[model samples]
Target: MDIRQLARGTVEWDRLERVFRTLAERYDRTVVRVEFLEADNWLSTPCVVDDEWFVKIVTRQNALVHALLTTGRNVGAITSGTGGFFDRFETPLGMVEHEYEATKRMREIGLNAPRPIEAFEVNGLGVLVLEYLPEFETLEELPDEVVRELAPELFEMLATLHEHGLAHGDLRAENILRCRGELYFIDATRVLEDRVAETTAYDLASAMAVLEPRIGARETVDAAAEYYGSSDLLSAREFLEFVRFRPDHEFDTTKLRSEIEKVADLDRG
Candidate 1:
């Protein structure tokens, strides 16, 4: 068994059926077909219902994992010379509710996101429903040329989020979806509103980490330069080592630092 599967535990078949049945009753449908996604996700069991709604079934185990991840992320923030900024949830409903609100806020800010339908608890599971996108690809699955083309747009979106005092506490290739030539963000985690600078820098570092390997450090920094000032890039540089500690992020950190310093120097000159 995969370690993550073991860690995530399994939702009993009867419980899952109860969830589906509840969904059907809530949506006024006589029946619904569910297609489970084998996603590399630690927090939820994802599925598509009747090809119309994307759903996440969050269990007690998922909430435990989320708490653990939040602790680890907060520790990483401390190592990067900032206080703990990540928020933790005590229940599956809290996790789903936070994500639902975050997605709604993204769309409200003119950013692309799946439209949130509802979040509710059924049979001890947190169920979140959203509009399903039939066609899409993750940033990691896109071609290098496409990623290069989208890099600046990615920063533009991030900048807009930062400008509005919001941060995507989780910014990775998989969390970014390219659907029909537009980018859609998902799975934004909660962060402290009072620690805006620290969260902003961390988000920028995560974004560059996502792009650096595919687009090269120079181009990644170049893309960031368009939307962020040299100081913001420098702030992000502080968290590169911290971001690298995560298993999902792997990039040439040395090269990235050099590129950022070069850009900073040019701005200074």
Candidate 2:
């Protein structure tokens, strides 16, 4: 069994059944077909309803796990000489609501994201509904050449978020999707509103980490340099080691740091 599955403890069938029934009633349907997905994450149990809506069932256990992860991330941030910027939600509803709003906000600002349907609690479980993208490829699943071609576009999208005083607190390759040749971001985590600058730098660092293995470190930095300035790169440099510590991320941090420093030096010169 996957360790993530253990961490994201299974929800009782009776409770899940209640959720499905509620969804069917809410959508005015007599029945609904649920297709459970083996999505790799500890935050939520994901599924598809009637092949139209992507649904996430957030339980109390998921919320507890999220709080623990948030603490660890904040500690990493502090160790990186920055204050904690990641926010924690005490309840499952908060988690689902935040993602719903985040997706809506991203689309409002002309960024590519899933169409959020709604977030509501049912029998103490937080249920989130969104438009399902039937055909898609995560960045990790795509070919290296395809990732290389999309590297700059990824940076541009991140820049657009920062320009609007927002940040994608979680930016693993899994959260970025490609559907029909267009990029779509999903599962944005909540961050402290007042620390947008810190979150932006951390997001830049995370993006570089995701791309470095698929493309090279130099190319990764070059893609970022197009949308970010020397100061932004320098700020992101502080979070490179911190981002490396994440379990989901594996990249050559030393080489990436060197590339970022070289570009920053050139900009300074």
In terms of lDDT, the best-performing candidate is 2
Per-model TM-score versus the true fold = 0.99, 0.99
Minimal lDDT window, size 10, model 2? 260-269
How accurate locally, in lDDT, is each candidate? 0.95, 0.96
Against the hidden true structure, what lDDT does model 2 obtain? 0.96
User: Candidate 2 versus the native: TM-score?
Assistant: 0.99
Reference-based lDDT, residue 91, model 2: 95
Candidate 2 clashing pairs, residues 3+ apart or interchain: none
- Stretches of candidate 1 exceeding 4 Å from the true structure: none
- Residue 198, model 1: lDDT of 95
Q: Per model, how many backbone clashes are there? A: 0, 0
